[model samples]
Target chain A: MQEKNANQVRSRNEIFAERTSTKIYLEQASDDNPYIASAAVCHGYGVNEVMAKKSFADVFYLLFRGELPTPDEVQILQQLMIALINPGPRHPATRAAMNAGIGKTDPAHILPIGAALLGGEHQGGGIVDEAMRFLRKQQTTDAATSAAAHLESSTPIPGFGAYYGGIDILANKHAAQLAQLPGAGKALQWGMQMSRALEAQGVGWLMPGVAAAVLSDLGFQPRAGVCLYQLMGAPGVVAHGLEVANKPITAMPFVADEQYFIER
Target chain B: MPEKTFSDQQIIDSLNARRGKIISKTGGWFPGKGVFSHGYSMMDDLVGKKSYFQIVILNATGKMASAEFAHWVEVGYSCLSWPDPRIWCNQIGALAGGVRTSAIAATAMGVLATDSRTYGVYPLKEGVQFIQAALVNHQQGLSAEQIVASVPSRGGKPLIVGYIRPIAKGDERIRAMASIAEGYGFPMGPHLALAMAIERVLQEKYDEGMNVNGYVSAVMADHGFSPDEVYQIFTTLVASGVTACYLDTYHQPLDSFLPLRCDDIEYQGTAKRAVPTAE
Candidate 1:
């Protein structure tokens, strides 16, 4: 057994006076039958100690949200996960993962690099997260006015265009699929309203906007929505990273005449 | 019974023994020992039931945190996590993408690259502390210049003076974050006011503006987050951005980014002839 501290109690002020290295505080659970912290709580029982059975997705939700989600919530989580999981090599994070693998770096680093990139404010899940935030703030305003306002401010609209002025087919496809889910009714309707409002200006709803609206309707905050996006996107990133780990980067083809150098 | 002798180990252990809890007691209703998160009422009976945000506050500041303030932290995180890849640290990821570095290596490289005048958590944290300290000085009767100058120099430079990628006018991110802070019911403290004053003072005196770095300092100070705590908590907020840069340019051949041929190297020093014929 580890040695107990001198006194088990102290005033908060006193504790502040002598801040020590971070101590892992395990309350009430003594050395014998020690326990680790978990985020799953269901049916008034500890998931680990009490054997509360749940689906993998439900368990994941519990870990982040601190309670088992309803079946509908589970369905939304699944829908979002399947939709946002992988964008393949063209996406920055996936490409990062592939880049790592091509250089024959360790398998451990691939997904991490990809995931990290995807989480940035502009790229990764961050852009969508920002877009969702923009949408929420504009809840009082109509989509057209809001879109115009965003354009005026020079702030990038979250779910508008994938290319310079183009919509992503896959993203629209996912939105269409999600529109049919149990709780996605009103949210999808609102999303389409925004999409139609923007479409005249050659703008369309991308996955993030649809995701943000749908998740928001499902009661997830924008931050939580981004976390979910990140979670769903990681496996695809890792897969890309793993696939190219054995290959050397130099073996990849190069475009002709792309190698111009100034010799002066 | 064997004769008992005082052992040195026992003596040292007893001498080093503490009389009070080194860490504070939180009656926890949250996750512990991987048993899943317990609700507010549980037989687990740790000490206190706290939200994850509450625990974060406890860990950072040995104080209880209100739900609103904790949410402010979430809002703040959303703000800082969006520096695009073109910025300094994220560029490492871009370079990695261009160079075909390992994903982890690129991320690791980018994470490490955060240590600069531009990126890294410490600058913002330290900048906030500087403002706090400066306000104390200003209140105690010191000129703004004197207060700014009073901040110690590492290699003769004030650590938290100005922004990197120096914004010509001012950083809008500050206003964005400030608006968010105001929405959270956070009032501008003396430190924030002092930072603004100092920015103007410096700008008048040295033509500097209070950019995102100064604004971040103000926000952290407003939240009552000690400079040390800010760094400890949000170290990896934008690590994903770094990884994204690596992925952003993956379509190109290895080292295809800014591809330089043999002649691309401008050999200015000790040009030409190397081999000695006599040898």
Candidate 2:
């Protein structure tokens, strides 16, 4: 059993290593592009289109429960959402922001400002908007079916692909996963149709970037998306952080200005 | 009939040889970084002069093999420190040993200290302020029990666990992880099967039955999970399942409906009942 466990761990480690290697290579290959830094910020934060669609529900599950949910678990989530819907603003930070501003302000800006103050630099409005959009879209049509149809019809889908790049395997996988959930048959059906549509149109390959652009146009500010992505990407960040939590960062020696003066 | 060469206690003692240097280095939880460590130091500076307490630093740095892994451990440790008070020192090379050894030392010292204020510090390089607050509370000898008593149940922050499935489709490592997850009673495959099954049922229910929420609850309840775990389990299970099969629409017809099963329920069930059941 120990040996088997060890092997399993080893295999996981290898997969992670391979994933990291590919990412690093991509980073290195794209280092010369000025947009890479900005793109990196988005990618690092997990704000791209793919993550926007699926990770929220996944994250919600992990946060509330210790492990992943089953299909039944997904239903309970829907119920919980229903229960919590219209509970009114409960966040203290938002309340504090609202209270701090004594002067009467426009409700539109005031609400967003209050939300922004409460959310701070880490919250991404774009990610939230995208998530809401995907949720709303899925609510009306089968998510997979719609997604597939969107892909096929060459119609812009919100959260099915990556932003600023090619198709995101992660998002695709996540969407596919979501499609499999109880009642996601329609979504799956749509996704299939979309995929076929995209292939026929020869634009399936470019859908992610287009989807991202559409999301951007739909009021998902890139910076807000980035912040939301960071929050969503917390797990990966934590994983990386734990690796060196105990070890001392090798301090780089600093040379005094006087030394340079003396040499001169 | 073998000669009694050694007593059972003696044999046990021999096997339990004294392990070397238990507390090797301070972890982020105790003193390395964040507001907890900062607050701890501030409080220590303020009260250590007058308070009767021993500030021992519990370190878990030596056990960390990589820079990234160390950072993650530090972050987790920092996050866990919020509910307790312990002074976390931020000095490097102050303590030593593996995670287990350091944890044992901290527990021992924590239990033995006379003053409730006795604390430990574990710092990280880039600790967040929220984490620091937790560490400060820990150093001040605050316990989860005390925090719970003082704060409302719903007011406390929820604990967060982050994970990533970075493996590509068709990777042997992915397959291996799946297999291992299954072996470890993870229910990755079963969960996917169940989700697919539930989705079909939900679709049918929507056509012939109640509201979305009702159908969802019924489906989830059938699988023995409270509604809360459904979304998360579905997310992971579906991701893993799709990735495992590499079922790109191009490769397969993608038209067939997959059946789900109850056996794939791999998750922590609701808290166990308080009473014992008859055999």
Candidate 3:
């Protein structure tokens, strides 16, 4: 009687395990293609591969929030990014690991310590300090006067153009939204003046000064931009992980051949 | 004009009277070391007329560690010492309390030291905030009865407590501290840190015990400091009677034992200072 009962229990356990595994696999298969498609779209935008993942996260945030974040929210996001990027102050365990690894190692091999401890360069930690310097230089004076002084001083102006070329349509629209805010109209005007100055200097091909103006007027630290992108792309990593968990898909023959040559 | 002899009370009163003038001229809350020197000179006159009395120097020093009531024992000692005629001098440093307590402590101690109860020191705003945070934390988990029970009645005189930033010139800490100070509401005019450092060192040296003075003198002699320089440092230490002295060895020039002066200034927000006009 005891043996029969044990067999019945084993059968029930097997059924439960199978059901759980099946559910996970089905979920992974259903979401895997959509995640890839989203990643591909982000890649097309010229975002760095790591940032492409973040950009997808931003899309998720937008979809959830129903609008792009304001400058203040972006600043908060930047702080979060820094926390995500940097390791907590050195732990004794990590130090022990480092000490163990430290026998005549090349300094380049130690770069991972910084990479792991310091978040990616795209996170907005340092940018806030830089933006603050720029804002202070521009404060108190009218936008035109500030622009003129900034130009005279030969200070590098940020947010005056798109990253890759052509207009940054999103940034331009954001600037328009910022113009309606109190005390921001002047900033928008300054942005236009900066654009004209750049054009006069024969860099007319540069994108218009929208992002910088919006950021400054909103008191968004310059670091917020990278932070925003990082957050946007994070979902892509999750998506990729899901896809990888699905049945291992082999590439087409030519794609596999090309990859093999690239590796070589 | 005849040089008037002023007691500690008179000197403190003068400091109080000139507070506005000092701040406006120096662009800071506390007067420079030179101003303190002048006040000390006035103090000499009052001490000359009085019979020699034993003044115990209690140098209070500790990290602004946790907010426990026991943590403030040193602070309470300084406060308790204020009212005693025999314990005429006291110095407080690195205290973690709120702005109000710092102000109250400084004012109370200043009054006790000078025999005047209204002396005030304008510390950087950040320093004030730090003090306030400390006070708030200290007050937490305490009953009203416990607070009243903790009050010490002493030679019930007020003590003057001065806050000093002790970073050397051009050090990043100075800039960071200055920025924090500015955020708290007091901006350091140029060379404020240097002036504060010089004053703090002089004060600390003046307050040392007799044997400690001999030891310090010997150290100075071994280090090649002239007898007069040694004497000056000793007197300064005796006057300050501070428990802890932060010496900025990094940027301060070794040739002279003076703090460094740097040009870096940080404002509260991300703003930079306005461009300086060429001298």
Candidate 4:
């Protein structure tokens, strides 16, 4: 037998919003795909038209930034995406995903754990975004004063100094590649100088800050660039997750062993 | 292996012992470690092998949807995927974009917005339940009029409450969808035929046309979906257009889509009230 009546079922669904207004789904005047659309047209370029002619990099830029990137910008972004894609499984989020996978959890469930961790304030692209934001602010000033002021501040400057303090060769290599882009603005110039100064003080440049500088100069907002970090870092984590999930469940230590019961 | 026999009630009791998020054990053994579905291997057998629309219906109903039904679902999605970013649920996409968030965030928010009673998938659930109740009453040999009359007592409108309203004319989307379904040439089935009778009664009494939700619900009933299945399946389909709205407006300024200022609103309450001073 069915458990609930119509009203009884409907009553359970009420959300109890504090304020009420007629909800809007679409603007009548500006944006609507009327009737049947057999083919998708993006920014006046049809799918077939773009597919037969343009590269995916062009469409990706169009979707993300609302305009196709310059050829150089596309190349830069593509290279940056490749360069920053993974930082190995030792990253905390990847480690968490692998642990979840060890319990034979589905990769569908395990992959999201890494994605969520990447969105945090320190891991993934959060540090990269913070680095770009700080660099963008320091663009007007020269290296010495900007470095002195930021270094003296108590708040952690995420990009300039590594947590464990070592020069990141991967970040430095890609940073040089991206630094050559035609529209190297004040942000990139200031970012390089600050990295140099911070290095002298025993703090080294991490890949996130360098990547953030390249993305900022190419006209990405901090958060948007951070999304790329989240995207790039996913595969490595998922790979580790799949590897771990492939293991026998009996191999891992039980959670009961780790739990500490305190006597009151 | 030894053969065993169990009573019908005993089998039902065991199948429903654990009710978890993934329906892991209830109804069927769902070994979710790999491509766990109701019974089928979702990953190896279905993914990349079937059309996405087919996958949706297959997973939702545990079988391939009729070609005619699939066409209606496609049509229903096309009409609802109206690209306006300002609608109740579509606004979740717009709001996500305005905050400099990703399309994924907008998609998540868009799904949340549909968890509503007034405008969300909940209305579909209500509409389905209303029809189910009438179906029960009809199966018990009650007249259509008796079933319709009994609906008000159970928190259902004699005519289904809906998303779009026309003051004088019928909704064009409804007309288009009905025509599209007619083109399919499949029978509307018993449950859907009952819904159509209810619509006819409603139009005769109140001169109102079937709204999108009502029309879709009727069509869904024809597909042999239960109320819960209708609601869940509906959630998965509509987000196609909502996600598009987010991507379309990802780089636009906040004020670009729907503009409103404080001056646009009117105040009706008392002008001002002073808080009582602390002693």
Candidate 5:
């Protein structure tokens, strides 16, 4: 005989919020319709006022951080935004977008397709959280000791590691430039020392490492770093994708029969 | 190049060997001839002859399941196909439909949403692993009470993944599935026996019971299915539910699915202030 299921199906009655809440934005109802928003306030300032008074970086920071940035913070953030505007044409996320575009897939899907691929662990947003956390934890310690410990363990230090058998020269250069800014904080400074420590090991800054240091110094949470990395890299992915959107499928190389191998 | 401290020539060599070449052990199509999958000719042997569930299992696990097992798996899909938009994955479909997105996009997004660790397909892997490990422990002479005690607890209740459900206290789906299994004359396997024992201990001690994830994980483990295989098999478990939700909202007036007023959102942000000019 099948045993009767004695438990009754009942809701746990988890108390969800009565109204959806946000500390980020507030919308005022229009005079005519309660559903229509007449004005929007981000943090505290009116959206229109912000547009007139502040730069995009200040607005972006205010949206996330709940306060306007300092002059140094705004300048560093604006420069970082420019630095991370694209992940370049060779990146897998950008390549995925290009593939979709060239294949004549729906233009709407180019960003989504590429963004999804960018969520991967290698050279993507997946490691940004780790990089941020690593920076936070290691900034209190001696960077040279931490770098040596990680090297001895044969693990790529989260954020600091070798790229293609050598240090990433461009990433190194970017870090150096960002470090010179007045806004560079403890995390960024520690990452610079860590970079120097890793120089002999052929390990240094990768893009995520550089971004993670800046974001950590700027006070973004570790988890937010993941999506921020993806969001910042999205423009380049979309641009590169649209670049080849009108090209024929044959525009990309197709492996010849001789080049195709069946391992089994 | 900076003085090389790391030699990755071996790695580069391996990558170069496979450059511009496609190598596959799984079967692919030959344009002029036929399509192949797991060594079976798709058109000749599978299409009309085999059930879709059988093909799904074959493609997932590389082994063709019996028609009976396939039917059982198909029935399992029905257990999760609840069309209520209140469910998380289904709500994604509703939101997509409300925005007038394409059906394919809506369905795909809904399916993707089910990759969540808390309630959906990904949790099944942990569920299966827990039950399988518990059985091994049972064989090593640990009692059901011992197994229950071993798992970390919160508020004096065991925090096992498969046993406890999110929304409800006990699972109704388990009974529905058990009735079908009995009708099929499927023998009670050791893994399930241990699972029931653990559930008995849990229910008696903490008033908690086994969920559907627990039941399915144990049953699949008994049938020689690995955790990965089970996860792969049920990857689209909520697709039909998601589609039903999408269609429900898609046919309705736009932005009418639980429409919110401007005051519906409670603002907890900073007080109104002036924006400072950027230096």
Candidate 6:
């Protein structure tokens, strides 16, 4: 019987870490109490010193990359951050936030609810890692050749693909602009060429693709790229959510009964 | 160049069809009238008339499950509802409770965490897919040993999702669940038979046995559930366990769930240095 085998349910005896580890941030314990932190350091930079001397973009880049960005790097990062600040009112993530707010859900849940939906694969942060990996693997090759190879394939070229069956004009412009930056590297330039190659088929720069190109160039890991994509678009989702929060439930369309067709 | 348009008329038409309308095959509420779910009136036909699990399966799969099957599913849920916080999803709940977030938020987050590649609902789908595919392979004149060999291996062990348990060897839940299945008078169907044969091969060759996931997947497949339907039905499989974890920590002192000291974290990155001026 399987139940007899249950007696063999001994531990695998795997050795886990004695404590969690990180190099990102460190909170120095106070002299008085071991539990209390007296000082905080991010990548060896004193928090107070960073706050006084550095811009938010510089600190933000340092948080992930372990070093402060140069002027060109900071500029591109800041611009990309702004460009992706809001996924827009029509986006599903923003709409999720709006739905939560309009339904009078707890204000704290607004961000989480929207952010969770924003984690989807379609036009969301879910595909950012894949996009970043695609850009990294294909950046050294001919962009046009790589793009042509995927033209007939059913799967998208990851970061480089159509948005809503057409080119995302804003994303294309953002990629073009970022590529010209001094800090811009192979990923962004290759992506622009890939976008041009795909333009004939009405497929080009998606927002995630644009963010992936810049982030890959900036040396952010693919997984970090996913969270960063979500984080960058969060402000817009929260804003749209809060905008409709105080309004009545009627603020958003509920789809009339006649329009609510249940096929089954 | 002029703005490019979607050349696929089908996509445009599909979008246009639902532009201003909410077309649903599932049920919705009608104010002052009735709420419908899969052709049954929610209040009249479901409430107080059917078991909660039956309705849950109906809502998930668009097909009403038998009362016995629903009870079997409910028992399956019990097998998985371990209150141990060491499990990943439950740990999320514990962390949320430690931080004093609302219970709903903790449960929601934990449920979301279960949509993972590791030991959760997603893996359950993979388990079902594996067993169902293995059954097909068996019928096509493949022996159990051959079926086991077909699986991709990592580190010289088969990477079959349902067969091997993590953090333990044999599954105790399989015994408990099997007893319940017997009590419910479920026969050994083809899928379960194939699963057992494959388990024998694994036990003899690899010293690994089937986990509860394998048992449940085979039984569910035998009962005519598609992998996707089983996945949809078990969407909140870990919710109860997550809630239990939340309640355990919620009643405790703030930030007390697994408090770490400053030195507890091993910092392996850059050595301490002065912040450079902005470049």
Model 2 per-residue lDDT tens digits across residues A1-264: 111221122222332221111111112113455323333112122224324444455435433332334445445344323322221232333433333333333222333334333333222223334533453356456544665666567665543332222333333444344435453443234544454443322222122222222223223344444343333333332333333334343321223322222110
Model 6, residue pairs in steric clash: none
Every candidate's TM-score, chain A alone? 0.75, 0.32, 0.34, 0.75, 0.96, 0.95
Winner by TM-score between candidate 6 and candidate 5 = 6
Question: How high is the CA lDDT of each candidate model?
Answer: 0.60, 0.30, 0.30, 0.63, 0.86, 0.87
Interface RMSD of 6: 2.6
lDDT of 4 by residue, B1-279 (tens): 001111244445655652222323312222444444445556776567656666677666666765567667778777777667756678778776676666765776687677776775778887777777777788899866666566543233454554224232345566678788778775766766776666565555544445667667766776678878877676755576678788777778765665443323232322222222223
Q: Over the stretch B51-143, how does candidate 2's per-residue lDDT look in tens digits?
A: 221121111111112333223222323322221221222110012111122322323233222111222221111112222333346458754
Give, for candidate 5 chain B, the lowest lDDT window spanning 10 residues. B1-10
- Model 1: DockQ vs. true structure: 0.01
Which candidate model has the greater lDDT, 3 or 5? 5
Q: Which runs of model 1 end up more than 4 angstroms from their true locations? A: A1-45, A48-52, A148-155, A162-164, A185-188, A248-251, A254-264, B1-279
Docking model 5 quality class: medium
Per-residue CA lDDT of candidate 3, range B65-106, in tens?
Answer: 122222222232232322221222333321211112233333
lDDT of 2: 0.30
Runs in model 4 lying further than 4 Å from the true structure: A1-264, B1-36, B153-169, B267-278
* Candidate 1 overall lDDT versus native: 0.60
Candidate 2 or 4, higher lDDT? 4
The per-model DockQ list reads: 0.01, 0.01, 0.01, 0.01, 0.57, 0.57
Give fnat for candidate 6.
0.59
Question: How many steric clashes between backbone atoms does each model show?
Answer: 30, 108, 47, 7, 0, 0
- By TM-score, who's the top model here? 6
- Sorting all predicted structures by lDDT, with the top scorer first, yields 6, 5, 4, 1, 3, 2
List iRMS for all predictions: 41.2, 33.7, 37.2, 25.9, 2.9, 2.6
